[model samples]
Target: MQQITGREAAVAVLNDPRFVVPPVPPGASGIAWLRATVGRFSSGPAHDRRRALAVAVLDAVPPATLRTGGGHPVTVLARALGIAEPVMDLVRDVAQAYQPGTGDESRADAAVDRLVTILGGRHDEPTAALIGVLTQACDATATLIERARHRPVDEVLHADPPVRATRRQAQVATTVGRVTVQAGEVVLVGLAGGPAFGAGPRRCPGWDHALALVAGALARDSPSVHEGTPDTAPGTGRD
Candidate 1:
């Protein structure tokens, strides 16, 4: 694996055609299927379409609303998505298992099944897209909230990013910085050194919504409400 730093190099690696996200296996069900189907793990045109769908979901939930809304981030987000009942626990479970090697997948799959039923009966693209939104917002937003306690959120993001790195695979032999990375190698891009959100096609679309959630939490709840929480890396979908 190669480690990439600095904003310019990060941008180059992110936009380079020879590098792509390491794709999850297809032909899966539940969380595995959601992992394979979402834009976060895909590249190229599939990513474009899926990301657009995700953006459309975010589009429906204005950041301003989230900034002033009441409730846990997951609950607020779920309600914003038009879910009436409480699904915070379910969303958190799915988010915990959304990334590879994270949690009990059976529980997460069952959570995904419930979420699917809540959104709409069919497990299709739009439903998958909404799940993608909730999963991405989970730990990442919480980590941001914790880190922003003293410093401004902008500084917390650049100087001390909650998710410090993002992984990209080299599809072909490529030179990143002074190092020549071979095909099938993984390069860890240091988000601490890069442009905000991200710098290329996979840039986060729900940034405003994320920031708004963080701000709203800061305004609504005391930090003690989150005391003694287990340390977790932000969800793996930083970009």
Candidate 2:
């Protein structure tokens, strides 16, 4: 395993074709199924397809311009995804196990089951795409809000990002920032002080949506200003 810290090194690793996201276990159902099926854990053509699915899901769902009385980011995202009942707890449960080897799989699996039933059992990749958008936005948006309380959202993202490190596997032995990473080695790419939204093709596709959510949320939490505008103003090229 290699821990890459330099900004150039992280960018190189992220942008390089030789490095890919660590693959999640496949051939199983529930959380395993979700991980295996989602773009986050895939590469090559499959990754492109899955990523397009996720992007299409986000394309229809509009980010909230302001944090309303009942505006939780998760609920906002869920409703935008066309889920009549955006069960926060279920989303939270699944998000707990969204990442590989992180949360209680059994609980998350059950949550996925229930959530699926709510979605009318559409087990196709679009369903996975919807689920992925909601779960990914849940915890990540919340953390960004918390971290930005005493700082600007952009500054916080740069100085103290919620996702500090991301893992990549070297597909071939390659030199990254003067360090030689062996094939199949896990490279921990540090995002701190690096590109906040990442660079290259596999970079996160929801950063603009994320910023809108965070900006709205933080504005609501402010003592003097309860209502805030979205990240993009009226003239700011939203379309």
Candidate 3:
């Protein structure tokens, strides 16, 4: 694995057509399957379609809806998608699964199953898109809330990004900056020190809403109230 840390180098690698998001190996299932199915892990037209669906779903919710002090952004987004149950538990499990090698396979699968059911058991593209939204936002929003307690949210996001890094596989022999990368080699784009959200094509789509949510949470006299609380807290209703 080659780690690309320079901002320009990382951006080049991420945007170049000669590189693609790698796929889960054959026979991988459970959380790995969920990861692979999401737009974040795909390339080509599939990525385009899924990404558009996710952006549409996120865009449909007004920024004020996320900042109304009603519920965690994850819950608010879930409710907007028509899921009636409290979804923080499922969000937590999926968030853990997003971290490399941190989630139990069976547990993550169960979480995905429950989340799919909450999204109406349709198992269609829209359902998967909504799942992508929750998984992508859950941990990042939580981290932002915790870190904002000690420093400015922008500084916290720059110093310790929710996504520490992202990986891409070379599709053809290519050069990123001065480095020549061989086909099939993995290139790690370091995000912690690069940019706040990310760079290039794969930059986070939920960045605006995430910032709004964090700002709203911090505006509260008790920001920690949103940190790890159960979804059952009073006044945690939909926006």
Candidate that scores best on TM-score? 1
Q: What would the per-residue lDDT of candidate 3 be over residues 103-170, giving only the tens digit for each residue?
A: 56677878887777767776566776788788776766766677787898777767766556677789
- After best superposition, candidate 1 residue 178: deviation in angstroms? 2.8
Candidate 3: where is the Cα deviation over 4 Å? 25-33, 223-239
Best candidate, lDDT: 1
List candidate 2 segments past 4 Å from native.
64-69, 222-239
Question: How well does candidate 3 match the true structure in TM-score terms?
Answer: 0.85
Error of 1 at 209 (Å): 1.0
List, residue by residue over 173-238, the lDDT tens digit for candidate 2. Answer: 888777898989987777768566676887778887888877777767743221231221111000
What's the true lDDT of residue 171 in model 3?
83
* TM values, all candidates: 0.92, 0.87, 0.85
Q: What local distance difference test score does each model get?
A: 0.79, 0.71, 0.68
Q: Write the per-residue lDDT of candidate 1 for residues 32-68, one digit (tens) a residue.
A: 8888888888888898899999999999998988877
Clashes of each: 0, 0, 0
Q: Give the better candidate number (2 or 3) by TM-score.
A: 2
Q: Decide which is better by TM-score, 1 or 2.
A: 1
If ranked by TM-score, best first, what sequence of candidates would result? 1, 2, 3
RMSD of each: 2.0, 6.7, 6.0
